[model samples]
Target: MNQTYTIKEKTKQIFVLLIPILITQLGMFSMVFFNTIMSGKYNSSDLAGVAIGSSIWSPIFNGISGILLAVSPIAAQRFGEKKSNEVSAVVRHGIYLSVFIALAVIILGFFFLNPILNKMALPARVEKTAFDYLVGLSFGLLPLFIFNVLRSFIYALGKTRVVMVIMLMSLPVNFFLNYAFIFGKFGLPELGGAGAGFATSITYWIIMGMTWFIVKTQDPFSSYPVFANMREFSWEKCKEILQIGVPMGLSTFFETSMFAVVTILLSKYSVTTIAAYQSALNIVSFLYMIPISISTALTVLVGYEVGARHYKDAKQYSWLGVLLAILIATGTGVLVVIFRYQVAGLYSNETAVINLTANFLIFALFFQISDAIQATAQAALRGYKDVNLAFIMTLIAYWLICLPVGYLLAHFAGLGARGYWLGLTIGLLAAGIALSIRLIYIQKRKFTHIQVKEVV
Candidate 1:
């Protein structure tokens, strides 16, 4: 009865923790969906431009975000150990490092944007549109980077509500900006697809500014100055941040590169097909965040448990997180199955896009479950300061397995985009199983060691 009740409690706890995050995740998805819709509303070229812009820029942004994410687990572990003051230093250094990295991206993006877009075999109209968007977005990269660093600090402190709040506040701002720019409302120039990028760029700075305000005024334990002190910069701190962040950054590159490469391959099919793929991918990305939120919670929980030397509890919390992820994922899968058509229709009206996306959702349903498991397990591993394995696993899964299989299935087998998704599904399944077993083994070993030490 006690075990059953404990399990029930964990379920309730996870729901409480993750539901808000899911909402926040949806809000984030709204940012993507809204941008896609705005572009699509204008014309196919507009939509294509948005897709191209994302494909080109997302990898760089994702890689930088991954690097900064290293701070969360480290902060969580330190916070768990009751070293609360230590977190301030982590936040300070994280901001400095993220800014430095963002500046690098800015420089590279400015120099490479035109050449790269020009080289792509895109339509002249779409290339011009995409280039404008890319250049506009490049300016906001620093704001996004700084915002993400602050957000990571919030996540480390188990204050996901702040993210949800910021996302909520940003929606109206984003929508208004989209209207003002895309359609030339409020005296803004009608920039079409390029307007979508411009609005996003402007919104990013506002969000960053607002986020900084909230962190400084609202979050009590976070003591970093709104503008970082130049004196706070240190070689050791930057190196430490990079030590934890670089592997994560590389892992993101491996995963995102696989997706981007597949998109490039799929582009050969038809514009309609690529559009359908992006639509489905957008929804899948939102669904995947359910587990991601759980993982965030688990990172804090497990790290706290470990730092406190409560080995058994740490192990239990990891299991709790995994179970929570599966249960929530299964529920989400059912909803996707039931409302697949309706969901697809929300983003687009074309019969082909709706049909293809519905089919993709069928695969996406299964994909989410395994993806959740893998993400949660990986989060547990992060709590243990075991990120190196994630780097190895992602490389093997995405590059060695997923990418190759996707290429073969799409090209040689002539199965098209569905084949590419199937390859991703297989890769996710492998990662799920591998990560789960590894977490269980490592946690058990740690528990046994704790027991022996207690005996001594």
Candidate 2:
């Protein structure tokens, strides 16, 4: 009966955290949704242009943000140990790291963006628009990283609802800006597809400002004091963060870049294929927030338990998170398969794009489950501060296994877009199985140690 009660309590707590985080995730994606829709209305080429530009930038941005996410688990552990001062110092280091990474991205963009695009050998029009879009989008890189740091801090403290409200409030503002700038409404310049980039950059600053204001002014976060000793620099602390975070960043880069590579590969075909691919990919990414949110909350919860030395509870959290993610993914997958046509139509009215997107959803249905499981399991590992092995496993699964198979099937076998997606499904399945096995192994090893220590 107590075990049943504990499960029920944990489920309720998970939902409480998961719902807000899910909404925040969706709200953040709404900006992309608006961008895709607005650009699609302008033209398919414009939509494809924005898609290409986003593909280029997202991995860079998300990769660095993933590195900074080290703050959450680390801070959560410290917070669980009631080390408020150390939490603040760790967050300061996160901010410093974010600044360093933001500069690195800007430098890489200036040196590499053009050469990379040139190498892609895209059509002249698509190439020009995508280049412009990325140029406009680059302005937001710093603010986006800063916002992520603030978000990681708040989330680790379990004040997720604050970030959720801020993100939700930004959606309408983002949409209006996207609409005005893209169409040149109210005397704004008609920047076409590139305008979405400008709008997004501006909205990011607003969200960052709001997040900062909340952290500074709110009661829930007041005790933690993020700004205390704001000027202090700690190379040792930075190295500690990088030790764990770099692997995570690389792992995320490998996974996201796989999709980006697929996008670039698809570009060799036709605009319709890329558009259809982007549309289907966008839907799956949006629905993926459900599991991703749960994974994130589980990270904090498990990290806290681990820090408090409640290893059994941490193990329970890991398995429970995986179970919940699979359940949610199953339901979401069924819904997408059922309404695949309508979902595709929502992105665009083009018959070719819609039909292709609907077909892609079939593959999406299978992989969504795998994606959820892998995501949750990885998050749990991060909570345990066992990040390096997960990164190695991801590298093997995505780069060594998935990408090679995907390329062969898509190019050599001539399966085209469908074949690439099938490769993605296989890769995700491999990663999911591998990570689950790792999690169980770690849990059992720890459990055995605990049992023997008790006997001793």
TM-score of each: 0.88, 0.89
TM accuracy, model 1: 0.88
Best by TM-score: 2
Model 2: runs farther than 4 Å from truth?
1-5, 40-48, 122-128, 186-188, 266-279, 341-359, 407-417, 446-456
Give the worst 10-residue stretch by lDDT in candidate 1.
1-10
Q: Candidate 2, which ten residues in sequence have the lowest lDDT sum?
A: 447-456
Task: Quantify all predictions' global Cα lDDT against the true fold.
Answer: 0.79, 0.86
Runs of candidate 1 exceeding 4 Å displacement: 1-9, 222-230, 268-279, 339-357, 409-417, 446-456
Question: Would you list the clashing residue pairs of candidate 1?
Answer: none
lDDT of 2 by residue, 1-456 (tens): 011127778787778778899999888877887998899898888888898887787787778878998898998888777788988888889989888888888898899989998997888777877988888888887888889988988888877898899998999899999999888999999988899999999999999999888888887777777888887898999998898899989998888888877776787988889889988998898888898899889888888777666677778888999999999899989999999999999989999999999999999998899899899999998888789989999999888878888888988898888888888888888999999999888777754345111332
lDDT top scorer: 2
Q: Return the clash pairs for model 2, or none.
A: none
